[model samples]
Target chain A: MKKLTLVLTMLTLSISISFAQEVQIHGFISQGGLYSTEYSYIAENSKDFSLDLQEIGINFQTDVSDKLHLGIQLLSRDVGVYGEGRVTVDWAYGDYYISDALKLAFGRVKNRLGLYTTIQDFDFLRTWAVLPTAIYDLGLRTVNATLDGVQIHGNLDTKLAGNLDYAITYGKLNLGRTSDIAAYAGQLTTYAVEAATTKYNLGVNAVYNTPLDGLRLNGTYLRTEQFAFDPIHQTLDLTQAGMGVLNFDYHIETDIDNIYAGAQYLFNKLEITAEYNMGTRHVKEYITGLNQTVLDMIGKGKPELSDEKYYGGYLGATYRLNQNIGVGGYYQIYMRNDDLDDEDPRKSTSDIALSLAYNIGYNMVIKLEGHFVNGLGPLSVSLNDELTGDLSDLEETWMYGVAKISYNF
Target chain B: MKTKLLPILLLLVFASAFAGEIMVANTVNPEMSAADVEKIFLGKTKKWSDGTNVIITTLKGGAVHEAFLTTFVKKQPMQFDNYWKQLVFTGQGKMPNSFATEEEMLTFISANKGAVGYVSDARAGSLPGNVKAITIK
Candidate 1:
């Protein structure tokens, strides 16, 4: 049995309960069991029941004035070698409400991606035990979770079209050295990253609440400038006639552009949603350790690689059988390299997920979910510690199950 | 698909089972439209026309709360609660002051300067001195 990292977490001990009544403070903690039949999905030990999936978050918010509000949330989690129970500032910002039409905020702001990005935390509020892996890839969560800079958002009411809520953010992605985004960049050169940052990024998300009582449509777009990844000390040894050893490094840069569109209908107890994501990542790799003669002989070719287009979508629905019991599921199709056909098993993944959740009350929820997946996209072959070295061999089909209990106040 | 749709359709059909009459009251007591009512309860409208910060109140969870959410706010009780939770966690908006009973909600509306809330029609007969019910257009 894998070690059960403390299953029950009580985070409110340090918080003054009496003061909490007056001040705005909230939190949630969840423990999950992850089991996979074959290849490891998230944690390296998920081949068996693993308790490595857990999260705890606490946030404090206050209103300085009617026009300005400030808040900060701290989060800690353990998923494989990624988080490792390290606490980090999830999001902190000061929002200045200028009017019903426009509000400005600055600091670490949530990246308003598609329907679920903004609310990735607070598991009890969502229907799925795990978000659709294709669109909400855990490996890329750090890159898509939050941005560091400024945001302007508000609502616009139109007599004809509908009520539109929109947000525009300009910032750099908050990527840590060990996050999958940075690690993936380093993997291109077979090196390790010490530091990384996105140069310039602008994102826009607009949601139109249609006149129909239960329907809404949303669209989001993100454009990023060149991303810089500084590699740790590396040495590339070459076999040549007179070359003894070469001490050199490579510079890795990439640019990403993303667009997502979706529609949702919440009719009483039935909620249905359909969304699609499409994007292209342009990777520019440079080998800096070779001499001009060596570079010429090596045929370094063009430094810039052609853009890789990726596309994916999901159709999902959830029904509240009553208030306490609800069942939900989704069918998703994803293609990592759109240039290739579905015949390429490693580049394509399709998944079917079903879940049943029970709310003990308003504050606690228990959920059990099963995922049937086909292909290698969800395995994170290039990122996971256990899965990275063995890329040549992989199962085309796999499955995993999750059981989680969460509480909040 | 039909088997899955059966439960959903039945739930949709029976959603009207949540029935009751409730009055939307506020200290500001401004004339508004049904759209305005929806926006206020949703925290989309944070201020009143006179430029006062609008304070909101609600009953924790009950038949009256469910009826109020369904009738005036046009949202499921759980959905409305989750919407506020999402906003509160995101720092977009604060959760409205929630009470266990309509009496407590009425008391909160009376004490706060620009507070707004709702109550069952049965309780609407007797009004507090400072709180007044507003008509939704």
Candidate 2:
């Protein structure tokens, strides 16, 4: 703890010294209440509303030279079982401008995956209290937010095609045991699991700013490999028919590939956005003690899991009423098909959401949002720890409401 | 007839009060287009035509600042702030220098070679010898 206090003191002093120069300090605080009608969305089910969702972040930036800059952001958040007011370094990177069309960044930088992922936590920058759950799911926040490594980005201007902005990044991500993904994965096993770590992550994103005003087209691609320790299990032991028992010291390896395409257009006071995402995952389990009987019972010749594919997208529109108020709505759908059967309701999910936001002042905003969800989707499985059975016992339809207030400066 | 004309005259006066024009250091080349101005302020254009770095400055809050954004940058103050914040947080770009008044803006632009800024049209005539208004075409 002495080292931690020393680090904090140094950070405070550095911020103060930078402020004396040309540093920029900006921050935001957001608080909200979430209520579900049938099942829990982000917290345990309760008769009264839950105020377990909130976030605060502070960002500091300064230029070391004309072509070199540094930035860092600290964030603390609480959402159900994750965040819990833990102050973490969201991003800290050094950027060097090589030229007019080339720049490089190193350290912990935000991942440029999709349109909304880079700015996912900045509620003051969006019209809704929360982004679309299908694309920017809260359970996958840590995996999608930042990477510790290097990034190269720039813009290319053309006479005919307008401007093209591109970014390529390579890095590794550290996933904590308490992360939402680990917690959810742990529920699938009986052992006390640790956090998963990635071998490496690579991504590329490009955006074409068309000649048409307020219109842009974008595409992103990312690939990563992750390894997690089961440490006490091969797979969920189905010997007791779903009442599984675990063996010891196994390794789970997964490879993922994702692609996203998005478009945005603005006309007068109206804004329209649409995006589609597709992902594929391959999983291999390494178990120490595996017999032919276990393999035959699991219906697999080897300890390999079947490949999974999922696709989802959303179409959204927002209309501004003067400058202080805005109204928006969206329809989104997702399908997870490990069995390749479209007839199964468990494979498909859908949701429709409506939002109203009012700017209380230049730096403060209040938003009210509602969502009606259909089908037992990924959210239902990951969010609720009580639901131990399969999709057959899950609620098919549910609704939730949220009221959020935020201030930024 | 006079009563009806009074509101129109007052509206015209209000609009004219916010009318502003872009300005640059006299050392900068005189061949900048409105598109170039837009690109420079948006951080899309990092250098001048002569390959010298481009310095961008803005007034924090004023009629001229509002008019400059609406007429050229095509964004509100809040939207512009959010845009730069996004870029800064993502390590793509940095915020330009901002002044609290037109006088400070003019002083900085006058002292710098590649500086670009805006001022009210009425105040354009008072610019010093080192600064000049660039017509947006």
Candidate 3:
């Protein structure tokens, strides 16, 4: 059905172009090589080169009239186990310009959640091959990047304060057969979980351009809803708990609230950036089976639902030695549960990164970066680093490196 | 004749050295603030003060192009290009039309309503009657 919709949309766009207006097409392609130590950072095993990161995209934009425009981008990526190289409609929207203070857009619109949400695949735009992982998780790209809904956005100028570019959006998530959310759930628990949802998401974003050149301040808020999973592949086999290997089915539900504040300053050859975001999640679980009663009796009588909060941010700076060479780095941290003690291994994850990039020309760039990491954020240490069974062998301190080359036109 | 032409030649030499500066031109207005020029080119200001859609044009790439963009948009050429490309791909705005020569850009601005663009000061000397060179305040 998604493929059919894409074909129909493409056909309609082609017809419109042939009979009515001119359309501009642009695209980019990037490939990356990765290697990590002490865990399955990106590959099946650590310490081996993995060429699992790749991306390709093509976009179309056309002005149908003085006050109307249409645009769409089809993107494909395979980064480890996330995208799997399937083409997706990254964003497809129609915008109507009502005036300078207001514009209405409908369809799959990009979410301006943070300084980098909309530029996830724009490798050539920044010196970093990947954004700060603490806040911009690659695993959540499928849903956090864009939405299928409506948006109202515009610019307001205040003579002394500067210009405010703002947008408000409401939409629904496109839960598909293959989504990162399901994979993320499976990683946390050894189960075949499928994500199902029809909940709507809401977001508001605004950026204030400072009177000082090369400086801007941004703030954003988002309320996103998703995640309802059915019973696991099979119920838990609780033989050790005196329950004779019983079975039970359970369902899970989730809701999320997010807030972000950031600023960017660019002066001459130097650019500095800083951002912080907090994510609050509410989760509820429903157990249906006789074994659940025994589970409560075993001192595991925790509440069926609870609210948890996580936060992360990064401070980075990039400098251009010349057009051909640039360097950047950032210090970032992600607290999976801020309430946990500071020294707990599961409490948080932090990484310090350094990157260098060289431009081959105006159209191509090559970047090399390294990340020194501490902790696994929320991932269980018991997870099989090699996916072969035993997750008991792990390290708190690890490092990874990636080199990528990208081209666009 | 020699005395008179020497100062004229000196003045011409000085003007030629500074003629690399780009002048914002449009048929809709004869003058505008540099701040407005910055907003218009960045896709932030979509409509003119008169409510007509602001049509933006650009030189394909050259010294004049770089000077105008860096002077107003405050971004390097490639960064500016990347900025618009990001907006275009994200379905946020349209890419400004680009021409290889200043004359072609001039023709586009003259023919289109509310069209705004930058041209070499040398080209501003002979603008069409419909197109006016904007005075950057």
Model 1: CA > 4 A from native:
A1-22, A178-190, A236-244, A289-291, A382-394, B1-19
lDDT of 1 by residue, B9-108 (tens): 0000111343254444443443566566678788888887667677888888888788778776778888898889999777687789889988887766
In order, candidate lDDTs are 0.75, 0.72, 0.75
Candidate 1: tens digits of C-alpha lDDT, residues A10-121: 1122223334335588889988999988777777788878898888988877676678777777788676545667777777777899998899998778888888888776
| Highest DockQ against the true fold, candidate | 1
Candidate 3 regions exceeding 4 Å error are: A2-19, A230-249, A288-303, A339-341, A378-394, B1-20
* TM-score of candidate 3 chain B vs. the reference: 0.80
Question: Which stretches of model 2 miss by more than 4 angstroms?
Answer: A1-20, A184-192, A227-247, A289-301, A338-344, A382-387, A390-395, B1-20, B25-27, B49-53, B61-63, B91-94, B111-114, B135-137
Error of 2 at A26 (Å): 1.2
- Candidate with best TM-score: 1
lDDT of 2 by residue, A12-112 (tens): 56556667557877788999899987666676652268898888998788777667777778888787656777887777777788876798988777887
Per-candidate DockQ values are: 0.52, 0.28, 0.49
Task: Tell me the TM-score that candidate 2 gets on chain A alone.
Answer: 0.87
How well docked is model 1, in DockQ terms?
A: 0.52
lDDT of 3 by residue, A1-409 (tens): 4753875476456537644577778889999998887676644443677888899998877778878787778889888767888887788887888887799988888889888889987888888888997778777787688888899999988867788889999998856666556666655556666565548889999999999998999899998775566555435666776557666666677788999999999887788999999999888766666544665764445537778898999999998887789899999988888776776665788899999999997789999999999886734333344434433354778889999999988
- Rank candidates by lDDT, best first: 3, 1, 2
Better of 2 and 3 by DockQ: 3
Candidate with maximal lDDT = 3
Fraction of the true interface contacts (Cα pairs closer than 8 Å across chains) found in each model: 0.56, 0.28, 0.62
